[model samples]
Target chain A: MSVTSLASQLQGLAPADGSYADLFSSVLPAVIDAIGEIASSLSTAHRVALAGTANTFGDDQLNVDVAAELVLRNTLAAKCPSVVTASSEEDPVEKPVHSEAAAVATRPEHCYTVAFDPLDGSSIIAPNWTVGTILGIWEGPTAVGQPAEKQIAAVLGVYGPRTTAVVAIRLPGSSKADAASSICLEIGLGQGQQASQNSEVLRSSVRLAAPPFKTRYFAPANLRAAAQDGRYMALVSNYIQQGYTLRYSGGLVPDVVHALVKGHGVYVSPVTAQSKAKLRQLFELFPIALIVECAGGLAIDPADGSRILDRVLQGTDERAGLVCGTAEDVEAVKKALLA
Target chain B: MSVTSLASQLQGLAPADGSYADLFSSVLPAVIDAIGEIASSLSTAHRVALAGTANTFGDDQLNVDVAAELVLRNTLAAKCPSVVTASSEEDPVEKPVHSEAAAVATRPEHCYTVAFDPLDGSSIIAPNWTVGTILGIWEGPTAVGQPAEKQIAAVLGVYGPRTTAVVAIRLPGSSKADAASSICLEIGLGQGQQASQNSEVLRSSVRLAAPPFKTRYFAPANLRAAAQDGRYMALVSNYIQQGYTLRYSGGLVPDVVHALVKGHGVYVSPVTAQSKAKLRQLFELFPIALIVECAGGLAIDPADGSRILDRVLQGTDERAGLVCGTAEDVEAVKKALLA
Candidate 1:
């Protein structure tokens, strides 16, 4: 059976001009190109050549991380003129929060705000574990101290056995979270689909729905070491007793994305006194929250078990713990934590 | 930098004529072809289309898994005439134990015995986690119940951010375990490096040595559920209490390979009565043991403090848990188990 191109699908599902689809069409290529370049550069020599420079996040940036961000920045600037403001994990410059309407009112050309983590799970590169790129496109500059309710689109490119893209876009006039649609597309990099190819097709995509309840779950256990009290440890122990299997790679993208893609299971980042949440609100939490919510899964806030997307960003770099998955799994986790 | 072809490397590493290197050169393409095809088919629809039919080992055979194994079989039969007998995880066939010399004596054409898990960690596919293909090449039919020390060559193709091949060859003049040399190569399938491409250049080949001790490890905690007694559970608990970050993905290939690539850390699969041992002796255990041991690591037996490669395969389908990693890590695990 012939595969359908992702661009073609976007054309069918989205409006022709200046829509979420159009924005995705422009940004995805740039992202995929960056992935292709990054994929090729994760070599031994490349690792050795990287100066141990830390990013704004304090996680040491490998040469590849900075290079990937450049590819993204350059590609977005060239291809996505609608992007009025851009932010990235590589460089955390907290630009003033200007509404897209406000920015465009002043400079009528720009239409969107973009934020990303160009190369996530960088530490797992040496082990050859799955890692990814994440992009969050907003109708305007993201609100600094508010929930991520305004996010219009989220895309994740997971590099594993194959390069794949999971994209979710909130439809116009559909403000409800469930109104968003998501698709997983195979971005066949270097496999006939050259970096210059205008359209990479969907190998296959199914509308995501939370899978039925299962005992399987994924969580990065490293946070347990940082937890001040024994509460987080006790919760994980209880989950284990309930037969939840641990599937963590210490990578935020693949671990949470696994829950979204598998349609079941929960991925947690618990907030503890000694250990604040490791996932940043702007670059990590908000984007994943939007994506997971769009997939009929819930992203819960640890503070009050509210919808995570409704929990506004405390600051550009505010941190928050997350518990996201199918309703059953999330509820079970919440129950365990409460207990 | 122009990449060298894998075949060219084989030409330089092995005898000019027919040797284990030649055998590998002949069979690797077949295996890698299977990987490229499998990589293309891990879609949501592909997973659903596969009837939940379990394979010989009772693991549900995703249609893709069977298809992948078939690709391996056909490719091997058509390309490599040197293989006397072949076995795969999809269909466990116990072939007669025959030496390479004996097979050559009988067939004159067959020179090597090959066994593989065409798709290791198929269950992890839904989650988009990294998985792999393991190939074990022996001078003769693998001994039914003998240690893996007799392996002449081992290759592991890990499908993660990029598809990579790690090949270890036992040098002819060197009988010591340290005599083996392993190289990590990039098998650029369909990405300009066609199957017909004479060389698949080494990406970055390094003579592996265990990295200095670090308190990091990967163990499939789910195995604890299958453990008959609390011994395995107790040991894992101790590691966790000691702040050893858990890094299990329920995939043996990626877990063990992670240790090899990281240069430090340990990965263990303890034998429990209920779980006899999830890792198969022939296809999974022997190949990984050979690679890890060759890379200056230790593969230990849990029952007695002996090398896993030194233990004979009890049956064609014998299963044994594995504890492999840097010598020091393995020693620590051994001491804990004994305690």
Candidate 2:
């Protein structure tokens, strides 16, 4: 019934001298708080009412998405002052901040860049499927097209039947090493230890459902728009013939979270000749790659068979061919593509 | 910000002398209460911990499913003593109760049969997609093989990003008429108007969204096992070539709820050669048929293009090819099948 708070989890995340620990301790709690706020607002408000009139990146903004973006921005300004630059799928371009508040944060020496999709899959909200908020932390004040390898940490807060967080912190000099050298954890949110009369309060950071992963697969047909190609369709048909059940909800967060919890499965969003890839590298794919790799799974770029975490990010809008799952599953995807 | 409660909505549902209103008033609250219990349990407990070790209908049971079934059964026994016989997807057969207690109910003259899938799409829980609890209410303790038209009311409680209830009530001699003659309302659950320490649930019976639906579609490839057949594949290929995107998550509740909320789309589960129909008529198909029909949509058997509500239920396990959505969409499905 009791869950460890995110604060404590971050406190113990790294050694006292571990820079990654200090960086996460500075950043994650604020992002987690924003997730809690979004969950509350969404649980009660009507979906259409929350559909904001503004347009962002060719999509209509949900008012809640805007609120979530502000919440994260303000929280970073206050609690994670080391975060100097930020970009979000909900915003037109990366913005600079925290120059005034840098003195308050724990690590002033390291200026971190935060790339996020404050509310991924917001359109799916009307249908009442799961959605999530994603954040990736990298070295100070990065540009829009920074590569995934520059990242130090990645965290995803998934709001579904219940709220859960998946966090991955990469230690120094370990990008090429196996999962045993990295830190990956799934955190379950429970009632805050603070006994407030407000039922909306939540407690996060209980490390539960750590992954070894079971076999499963999830990819919306839309994500597999590439499947319209005979080659890609053949790849999908291979999975179907192999008895893989489709588990996509058209939401990146829940789809990836399913792999984390279930412990096995491929989530493919391949590039199509006529259309670009759908999952953005910085905002969506990179953070998920970090979490998946740290969880003992592999996130592969099907085009080159390179690790997703090592892919070159072209821009904030840059997308890639993604195939993430257990190593064997990812290999299966690769083999099918090549075949 | 305040919304109406289910109790208040149902109170105003039918005229004072309306027998349909009285039946729903006796039944819906009890079913909704069970839904509340399941949502609470599922939101807090671990999925594997909640996995009931027992298998039912040839699948591993989630503990929440068994608990949910018991909750519904007990609620019916205690609150709706007029419910004389009951069956559930979790239970193997129909069970009788309340022969003596029927005298204590408000509608003693009626013996209602309650058949339900206490937790539909429960297997999808591990992935944290939307799942729901469904109930169908029929007259005179109807047998498993009774026709769907014998039912006077139907309700489904969807536990998704938010909790919602969709109810359809048909007054006597109104079956032949269109949706205008029926009462279809979508209720949003908030804290009880009662001063309980439980969550603040209100209900909204807004009529913002209605049918004359847009063109969209959802059917899991798994349910489209029939699609493996050359003819069915051709029909599906037609939809794909026409640019209809796949939106299925293999959960009837959320899939249907999407159609209801978005005011569009079709959800199909056709019988395959290797397997019977994936959805049960009494538990899943019939109740949804009632709700779709009441919402100005249609539910038809793909085999003969007859209305789903008019089909004779062969037994509790009897299955049918389901095609539910707007009337135009249903006709499209009929044409595709017959072609």
- Reference-based TM-score, model 2: 0.86
Which candidate tops TM-score? 2
lDDT of 2: 0.67
lDDT of 1 by residue, A4-43 (tens): 5444545565555656654656655555665655555542
Model 2 root mean square deviation, Cα atoms: 4.7
- In order, the interface RMSDs are 5.1, 3.8
Going through the candidates in order, what fraction of the true interface contacts does each contain? 0.46, 0.44
Model 1 has a DockQ score of: 0.33
Candidate 1 chain B, run of 10 with poorest lDDT: B49-58
Candidate 2, residue B91: Cα displacement in angstroms equals 1.5
Candidate with best DockQ: 2
Kindly provide the TM-score of model 1 when superposed on the true structure, using C-alpha atoms.
Answer: 0.82
Per-prediction TM-score: 0.82, 0.86
Displacement of residue B163 (Cα, Å) in model 2 is 1.4
